[model samples]
Target: MIDAILPPAVVAAESFDDPPAELFPEEEAAISRAVDKRRKEFATARLCARRAMAALGVPAAPVLPGPRGAPQWPAGVVGSMTHCDGYRAAVLGRAEHVTSVGIDAEPDGPLPPGVLGEIALPEEQEHLRALAASRPGVHWDRMLFSAKESVYKTWFPLTGRWLGFEEAVVALDPAAGSFEARLLVPGPVVDGTKVTGFAGRWLAERGLVVTAIVLPSAGP
Candidate 1:
């Protein structure tokens, strides 16, 4: 599922079932005080990450969390991790080939009541409503939340700033299995000119929704 959106330069690992891998000591130390579920998810996500590193030909090392809880990748590497029930994935690329990457997975279900109102702008909600009207089976609201999350994950490393939900408008094209997030702020400077938003791809299957974005062409 994750491979469809990634380029050949990117190495990715994915698991539909938990693999028998333990957390490295440093990773364990960071999550030691957390609940068991959190620990399990962290360990599993790292397992996928390790496979990605190996595929990228990087020696194994501690993939620990940084100040803001984002994974600290090896020097000259950029990557992202994502996990949800029945799915976990990691993508890695050389820093020269990609500026940043973001991936997320979620259960294919509707957001809890009123969540759409919180995370979407008036125009965004209207768009979602139209999408829902056309495709009644999909939970477009939840997809927007997931897309916003992917947007932030992709945005932060590039600009080192916070991106509010209302600050970006998401438009999803179910037919194409893609989405675009238009920034409401000054937006990040990609290449030379300031760009409005990030482009991403999505997949909804087997009761899961997965999204990914990579900044390869938009150099660092």
Candidate 2:
């Protein structure tokens, strides 16, 4: 039932385990059947997460459900998850003692012109301009969209607040296989959280874009 698959990384991963017809339980409900596609999307993400942890030699700990429907990792592990139209991904590391991590994947597509203005700050707009000039025909909109979602997944658990797109700035360096972000306002998710230089990569093959965020050990 799980036809879609994520690429093999050093991390632990699984195909859809929940029903193939739907990713999440039917009780969760979807606005439309198409949204149900995300069920498989989410399922694969968790599977990949488990695999990624195992690859790291981390034990097979339960993904405990947190108060706000977030996945809680085994003690000493820090990680994050995300799923889009066709793919899902997760990354794990030792908790406070190890490092914080986040991952995201998005389909390549056009970005509505209006969205670029709405979500991007002035500096971000400039950055996008350069991306566009360099990679004409590539959708900057989609890139920005995935970038912010990656940022949220990377920063939110630490601060626990929902983030807005404009609140942060992103700088991408395609040549180096990485990008950077600077979160301006904290909001509830990462209050006063100054992530001056967060880095990540975009894997174009296998129809997936991934990001990995690592924070210093915020623990004993």
Candidate 3:
């Protein structure tokens, strides 16, 4: 499901079932103090991440979280991981071919009551309302949340800065299955280009909403 949204430069691996809890010694120590559910999710997500790294022709390594809980990748690699109930996925790319990657997954359901107001700006709320009216089946609010996650995932790697939920305004195109996040804060510079926003694709199917953003390396 994650592969559908990412570019060819990215290698994506996803699993619907939780595998046995296996982890590298370092990875286990990172989450050893967490609850059982957190441990399981962390293990499964790293498993998916190793598969993606192998597909990208990189040797497998323990994926430990760095600052802000972002997965630290091997040198010369950029990637992201996300896991939710019944699903986990990882996507990776070589830094020479791809600038950065961000992917997220969530249940295809409405945002919990009142949560949207806190995360979404007023303009985004109006846009989501129109989308909800036109496409009643999809949970636009939830999709917006997922898109923001992807945006921040992409943003942090490039800038090493925090982006608040309200700092990026997302506009989702229901027909295109795509969204764009315009950063209200100062943006990052990548490959000599200043990135003011990120454009990504989203898919809602099989009871999940997945979003991905892949920025390619700048041409010489």
Candidate 4:
């Protein structure tokens, strides 16, 4: 059985242990296998997604794979899922009533080298560099990485295309524990062209960094 932790709607977190069976057990086992660690990570993510849907009063539907290796949620609901080392989290909301939501969690650690150059937009890279220089020991790099992943999850479902790190600019307000992301060059994946804003927050705790993002709802 999976364990779930839920908070109120403003922000929430959920986690669960990996299940023994792969989410889809009926399919023929492929000759090549994912590393043990990745399989565990996938199980944890699926487990959290189920619990999160239940917490949000959405259907706890079975995990189903969709194009580009993303999970497919039941109709009328929007959500995001993520997992790292030992924890997973999912955030879901009624897209008709609430805007798009994205959630991500990762084990806290030193930032991977060159990560900033890859993910931060030009202005954002300069801003974060200055901030890091000003406060030498801060974990701004990790926070920024978490923010980027959250932004992608928030944007991908609505746009249906992969977004590059340079295309999205992130601005963080440390005092408020919040951040905002803007899509600079709408990529080939997005259509209809109305999504213009992204914003979110990051919380660091117990060796983990968690962030969430909100995008406007696609209306009827």
lDDT for each residue of candidate 2 in 1-220, tens digit (9 for 90 to 100): 1112222232434342343322334323432344645545555665676676777788655554464656777776777776666555566666534345556666666666687778888888888888889976556657777777777776667666777887788877767656677767843322245455456655454545555555555445
lDDT of 3 by residue, 125-209 (tens): 9999999999998999999999999999998998888999999999999999999899998897877789899999999999999
The reply for model 2, stretches above 4 Å from the true place, is 1-36, 59-61, 64-69, 186-197, 218-220
Candidate with top lDDT is 3
Model 2: ten consecutive residues of lowest lDDT: 1-10
Give each model's whole-structure lDDT. Answer: 0.85, 0.60, 0.92, 0.67
Runs of candidate 3 with Cα error greater than 4 angstroms are none
Sort the predicted structures by lDDT, highest score first: 3, 1, 4, 2
RMSD of 1: 1.7
Off by over 4 Å in 4: 1-13, 16-32, 133-137, 187-193, 216-220
Q: What lDDT tens digits, residue by residue, belong to model 4 across residues 1-220?
A: 1112222342344554666534545221421277878766766676666666776677657665566666677786777777877677666667664556677777667678877677776788788888678755447777788888888877777767887777788887776778888778754332355666677877767677777775544455
Task: Quote each prediction's TM-score.
Answer: 0.94, 0.72, 0.97, 0.80
Candidate 1 lDDT over 125-180, as tens digits, reads 99889999998877888888888888988888777778799898889998998999
Top TM-score hit: 3
Global local distance difference test of model 4: 0.67
Candidate 1: regions farther than 4 A off: 217-220
Position 115, candidate 1: lDDT: 85
Residue 57 displacement (Å), model 3:
1.2
In angstroms, the error of model 1 at 92 is: 1.1
